[model samples]
Target: EKMPLTPNGKLDRKALPAPEGALQTGTEYAAPCTVTEAKLVQLWQEVLGLERVGIHDNFFEIGGHSLRAMTLVSRVNKEMSVSLPLRNVFFYPTVEEMAQAISELERLEYAVIPQAEARDYYPVSS
Candidate 1:
């Protein structure tokens, strides 16, 4: 029950045992592919308090809940600068799916601009 230490009294990182992948969470580990996916992974890991989070990992399956989902949404909206609805979390639990959704949303980011209402009739070129 002791940690491997070097002569300098520091923890020996090399001596430590490697984690056995996803902590046996029954899901194959797949690292994030794109920038969007990578960012989602980082945020999921932070919210779930896990050392590793794969792109294909299910948010709820990997210790996620409604409350945590809200927090994750808030972070995504603020950091990613996109309006990611909370319902999307459940709709797209995996990072891969979420990333795709994000890209689609980003594509339509400026599509919701409101325009000034025009009068009932066209204005004359007076």
Candidate 2:
């Protein structure tokens, strides 16, 4: 359906109705399950100034922007000690996806780290 326009021939944004299936009404809210998810949710809440955040909630949909996204990435890196690409948050944009990416990165880092080994050194008499 076409959107309604004002007298000046501009689209009336305020008159626009919420998108179908986008609004969650009377639905039971689910909290973050894992530690990563929980930390992400907390960071999101602090950055977005929202009271509650769900794992599936879109970051941009909840008032997140590019600057906020950077802040989120920095916080995640500091808190989780994982280097997450900025684009990853844009691509994922959800706690669940970001957490999964972090987990994967952690796993990859673990695999790449070499195990500790003892090295024998001999001294030569001069």
Candidate 3:
């Protein structure tokens, strides 16, 4: 007897397709490094109508196209205040990875301020 191979001509059953551990059993998601990733996943689920979306899920595999990606980016910009370069999203497709990258970007590019309505300069009284 011979073993079976997948349609792609690779070892099928021997490959072990699913995750080894209980990665997604809980109600709460693992906290993402940046707000952008958390919101991105939420938006993606709403746009795609998915029951539950894992951070590692592939966008293209879930029927995402360039136009949808553009819409997603627009939402991200409006909501997260992060102007993601179009290419960067494709490069870092996963939520966790993208979050780490965005967190790095925030640390490097965006200056953190304690107050939202902080004046640009101290008020001058004459």
lDDT tens readout by residue for model 2, 18-109: 66653453334568999989999999999988888898888887788999999998778777778888999898988998898889885222
| lDDT of all predictions | 0.89, 0.83, 0.66
Colliding residue pairs in candidate 2: none
* Residue lDDT tens for model 1, 1-126: 799999999999999997675556688999888999999999999999999999988999989999999999988987888889999999999999999999988522323358869878876796
Task: List the candidate numbers ranked by lDDT, top first.
Answer: 1, 2, 3
Candidate 1 — which pairs collide? none
Between prediction 2 and prediction 3, the one with superior lDDT is 2
In candidate 3, what residue range of length 10 has the lowest lDDT sum? 22-31
Give one digit per residue, the lDDT tens place, for model 3 in 1-126: 566799989877975665475434333444444556678788777766765666766665665778877877666665676767777669876667666666665422333556757677787799
Candidate 3: residue pairs that collide:
none
Of 1 and 3, the candidate ranking higher by TM-score:
1
Global Cα RMSD, each model: 13.7, 13.2, 15.2
**lDDT of candidate 1?**
0.89
TM-scores for every candidate against the unseen true structure? 0.66, 0.63, 0.53
TM-score of structure candidate 1: 0.66
